[model samples]
Target: MSDAPSAPHLSRRVWIMIGAAAAIVTLSMGIRQAFGLFLAPLALDMGIDRQTFGLVVAIQNLLFGLAQPFVGALADRRGAGTIAVAGALIYALGLVVAGLASNALGLGLGLGVLTGAAMSGAAFVVVLGAVGKVVPAHKRTLAFGLVTAGGSLGQFLIVPLAQGLIDAFDWRVTLFVLAALVALVIPLALGVAGKPPAANHTDGPALKPALAEAFAHPSFWMLNFGFFVCGFQLAFVGFHLPAYLRDGGLSPSVGATALALIGLFNIAGSWLWGAWGSKRSKKGLLALLYALRGLSMIVFILVPLSPASALVFAAVSGFLWLGTLPLTNGLVAQIYGLRHLSALAGIVFLSHQVGAFLGAWLAGLTFDATGSYMLMWIVSIALALTAAVANLPIKEAPLVRSALPAE
Candidate 1:
């Protein structure tokens, strides 16, 4: 056999590309997470009920999910930078519009549609897709973990910053400031400039046929279904937890602190899961994480409501938050090659957003009807348990092509 170099050095440009991709994820997710802080203030300013605000946020989550698959496909075909830049512009516009909005329609259009569409383009799938292509196979897991951790850091850093801004200035001013910050992501997107050319092969399956193949896989469906529950649990708490705490007689500072803690702790949790997933059975670990999340929710709901309880819940729940992301994305990359990862992961994320829509909307409905969020908490727990069970049986083997003679 001819000998060739076994390992290659990563260039400075590749490191820069990775950093750019991580920053894009950080800014995009940071802005999205900060939206929760605005829920109460936006509703109060527009003279709308909590349900009205909840509905718009629900619409946002749904639209984000709906847009993701298409965005992912486009990013896979085109360069991620093009999509990232466009998404940054739209995200900035959304924040500005939300700041200027005088009615629910404007809020929905700005905060819901524009921001959601922008997020779809700039989300983790697109970033991870680029990173997967550039980073070596051995280092991909660690790279993805670092990028995901950046996002968690953004959430932790931006929320408290947003809260402080709101305290010092008006929420509208805070939004405009955020819009300006989001605009900076455009230049960062430019750093992910180069992408590999598509391989030319006459025997290769068409994109649609390949997608169909993925759809028929039992493991794919299991992952998709389980991710749906993940979205529901996370979105419900992200959007409503602050409001829930207020209803329980806690202060705004307490709510902000709780959110910050979740973000902060998730940084550690996501990295740990990513490292562990690389070494062990990702599916089994994912199942256990989901089960623990369900148990945590049950305990939080069953216990007495107090500031101390809320903080304890936040600390516990934060450890589980976003830990699912690394494993879920890693599985997608493992089963399918990184070549089609963005599109496949986007489809899975779409299911997640559908659950998010239901979770956010139903929480509002339940609260409006009974003036209590206890029932929704119970529903979240049940969904988590279902997700845990669904994940348990997923086959972790990579897809294999049938043996055939080359044409």
Candidate 2:
């Protein structure tokens, strides 16, 4: 009742905060997504094979997810702004180190360790956590959707720009340019500089009890597993799709266009999914999304590869891309309440990162050993189907402390 009364008068400050958070996501995600473009170039320059490049990227993905919970918890206690500013500086440093790297070790340290850590603080979980606390409950999902869309927007805008930069200059120079771009996050991050108001203090249990409650719940695990599938599918396709296309004799531009198309379409998808989730059953929609992804991938792989088909797949996949974040994050806040939202969401996101590590690394291994990506595609499809079914039995109601076992 108290939270509902002030819903009508959303202040200018709130909108600014939302915009800043979205912009931060734009830079962070935009730069990261374009890394796939550097795969071939990096391999050639470093005298490494596909698996080595993939492994380092996989390490980055793993580190990104692994760091989220601790970063999120720190954000919860210390304020998202502090975490974000520091993350931005580190992000820029990571890119610079990556640009200067002569071998895989340097890449792993820069891309894997530093940038991954930076993203944990500057990207989705931390940003959305800040947004969820400030926005009203009814409007939170939409705001999250809007923020999520920034990532795709970055992909759409930055990926092509990156491709052009790489084409015009060397990949190393392109990376340096990206580092400069990410440094802008430091200023924008300051716009969302404070913790949630005191009203949020009484909304849910403290961090320890909230962690205990979520860990004990069945629905939480269901969401985690479903998200794992999401991570696997996205990482596999995002990292390997370009190489797969090239293997099929498609032009490099086709791959770049496809990635941009995914980004472009996902902007709309994120918005629609976010709005729809406010009215619909999030778990049901998640089931449908996963099923559609599996169907899309199945069709893409089974059919003859072409620029048109690749572009079509990108558009479809893009729409479904980051929509999961808003719904899944919303569910955490909806069921568990806002207190400790970032930490819980971060934990769920860790499962996603683990899947990403396997997806990127395993796909490389399969491709190198077998000379084709068919096996990995089949595995992705199977996991997607599994996720679709796993999400069905999840309970959507808010958790009651009394319903839990004795502490």
What's the CA error at residue 360 for candidate 1, in Å? 1.3
Using all chains and alpha carbons, the TM-scores for the candidates as numbered come to: 0.93, 0.95
* Worst 10-residue lDDT window, candidate 2: 1-10
Task: Encode model 1's per-residue lDDT on 1-407: one tens digit a residue.
Answer: 11222323568887787788878877888777877788788766778677877788888889999998889888878878988888889989999998999999998899988988888877687877777777766566656776787677878888899999988988899989999988888899888865644732332244676688889899999999888998898888988999999998899888888888888888777777776776678899889999999999988888888888998898888778887887898888777666677788899999999988888888888899999998998888888898889998998877786642332
lDDT of 2: 0.88
* Cand. 2 TM to true fold: 0.95
Candidate 1 has what TM-score? 0.93
Runs off by more than 4 Å, candidate 2: 1-9, 199-202, 402-407
What lDDT is reached at residue 380 by model 2? 94
What is the C-alpha lDDT profile of model 2 across 256-362, one tens digit per residue?
99889988999888877776777689898889889999999899988898998999999999988988989899899998888788999999999999999899899
